[model samples]
Target: MSAAAFIRITRPHNAVVAGLTALIGYLIATGTLTPPSLLLAVIVALITAGGNVINDVCDVDIDRINRPDRPIPAGEISLGGARAYAAALFIAGIAIAALTPPLCLAIAVINSSILVAYAVRLKRIPVLGNGAVAYLTASVFLFGGAFAGIEGLVRNLSLAAITFLATIARELLKDAEDVDGDAAGGARTLPMIVGVQRTGIFAFACACGAVVVSLLPSGDWWGLLYLAGIAVVDLVILFGAFRGLRCTTPGCVRESGATSILRMGMFAALAVFAIAAVI
Candidate 1:
């Protein structure tokens, strides 16, 4: 396989971002940066890369219609090759976690299983899929906390909750965006089952919940800098929510635009978290 195809299968950019999330969690728990935290970040990245590749392998057929440019769909990478690559990464990630705390090893194994399940089946079942994604996102924080043994419980939980809620919102919006494609693939997403308008409302509610929870972290573990940064993030998130709310009917929502805005907001929120954690 070409190097580009291999890289494409891993979705390295997304994996790196997820790894950074683990680093954030580790820093919060330890209240300091260290080599062990870096190791945890690397482990998470490997696992995320495996997950993304497995997901692509599972969806190769669907992607032929919805996303033909992806490596597998484009025939740049074979499904068998992708599966083998993912297995190697998962084994590496779990082995590394096993070298750390026992809890970390358990989390790695569980998360790995969940990722496989999500790619194989859970992701076709609407809310179950969204919850799976959100839970995995939240687990990044919990996995970090496992290393240090509950020292940063409150902050980590708050971070996890915020990530969980925001991810649900994004997942809901993404389901709406992919409704047509998912429907063609026989997937039963919320938007496909309940129509886009109601799905939009549900997504808005989740986003609003995340915004509210984001505020709770302030004046406690975070200071004015965090509040200031979070306020901007909140505004961006609210923009997405407001746009989502305006979708009063099934066809009014441009799910792509809505999904994009929410993605930006979530990344911005993460940035705010990093700023708060240090400054």
Candidate 2:
């Protein structure tokens, strides 16, 4: 495969962001950086890259319609090549995690397995698929916090909660965007079963839920900086969700850029948490 094809299939931007988010979690929980913390970040990035590659491998058919420009559907990379690359990344991540604490190793194994499962089967199961992806995204923080012990986990719980809810909202909107491709691929996603309008409502509710959670005691405990920063991020997320809700068709939702907006909001929230913890 070409270098660009490898990068495209791996989605290096997202992998890098996931690694940075984990580093932020480590910083928040420990208030100090260490060599092992860097290792954790690397491992998370590798696993995330693996997950993206594997997802593309499994979604080739769906992507052919919804995202024909993607690496696989565009014929930039072969399926066998993508699968081998994904396996290598996953193995590398798990091998590195094995050198860390036992908890981290456990998390790495479980998360890798879940990523594979999500690609192979869970993604066709509607709400369960959304929940799985949400948990996986939120768990990156938890994985970083694992290095610091139970107190670290407790400290990062609110961050995880906000991430989880927002991810659900984004995932649902993505399902809406991919409704046509998913239906053609014989997948019964939420947007297909419950209808696009109701799915949009569900996504809106999840975004609102994330916003509410950002105001809870756990969030306040981080002080006004966090709350203030999150307030701006939450507004963006809410606006995205509102736009999603107003769209009854996949084409409209895609044109609205609801998923992209929510993704940016989530990345901003991670930055907010990092900034609040540092300051």
Candidate 3:
């Protein structure tokens, strides 16, 4: 396969999201050089990459309408080829996870199940589909801790829950941005059902709530600093939402800059948490 075909099949930009998930796991594990930690990160990355491929395969038609320049839609790659690529990535991920630890393997299975569900059925449903994606995204960190044999399941659980809610909010805002494409494809997203304005409001509330929760845990000044920074990012996101509401343009909503800021904030927060954990 050519380099162009590879890029088309892998969707490198989405791969960064997957890598971030694995990075969260690695940071929590805090064992950067350890074999188990490295293996765990690899597993998570492969699984996430596979999931992305599957998502594109599942959304080929929608993408054709929404993103005609995409590989499958643009005829740079065939649907069959995409499915094969996804299968390869999924198998590789599972193999890596199984080699890591029991907990990591179990989480990998669960993650894969959820991704399949999303591609097959859940993605068609409003709100529920987005929730599954968000929840899975948060699971990467918990999976990391598990790999480290940290008996912090409860904390990880709490983090996962909060992350899930936060991700849902982001997903909703994203839906608002893609309203036209989703609507054209008959996708029943939150924004499609509730209207973009209402969805934006809901997302802002979720973002605020996440910021508050991040700051709730005491013991660590670094974590607090991270949370404070995140709060500022949340404020910017809120501003974007309000602007989108006023503009009512897909471009405005989609390009709101909230997603990037939130991602950066989450990474910073995780880094601070890792530092606090060490100290």
Index of the highest-lDDT prediction: 2
TM-score: the better of candidates 1 and 2? 1
lDDT tens readout by residue for model 2, 94-203: 99998888888898999999999999999879899999999999999898888787778777887799899999999999999999977777878998988899999999
In model 1, residue pairs whose N, Cα or C atoms come closer than 3 Å (at least 3 residues apart or on different chains), thus clashing, are: none
Positional deviation of residue 35's Cα in model 1 after best superposition, in angstroms: 1.8
Ten residues in a row with the worst lDDT in model 2?
Answer: 217-226
Query: What TM-score fits each model?
Result: 0.88, 0.86, 0.81
TM-score, prediction 2: 0.86
Error of 1 at 126 (Å): 1.2
Candidate 3 regions off by >4 Å?
Answer: 1-4, 29-33, 66-68, 74-76, 150-155, 218-257
**Relative to the true structure, how large is the alpha-carbon lDDT of every model?**
0.82, 0.88, 0.70
- After superposition, the stretches of candidate 1 with alpha carbons farther than 4 Å from their true spots are 66-69, 73-77, 217-220, 223-225, 248-251
What's model 1's overall lDDT?
0.82
- How many backbone overlaps does candidate 2 show? 0
- Candidate 3 residue-wise lDDT, 1-279, digit = tens: 355875656666666566566656555445343544566656776777788788888888888877888788888778888898888888888887877668778888988889878998998889888889888878887887687665534345545655766777778877888889777767788877778778877877776676666656643233655565545645654554455445355577767665555555555556556655555
Residue-level lDDT tens digits of model 1 in 183-254: 666778888778877887888899889888988843244767778888898898878866776774434566
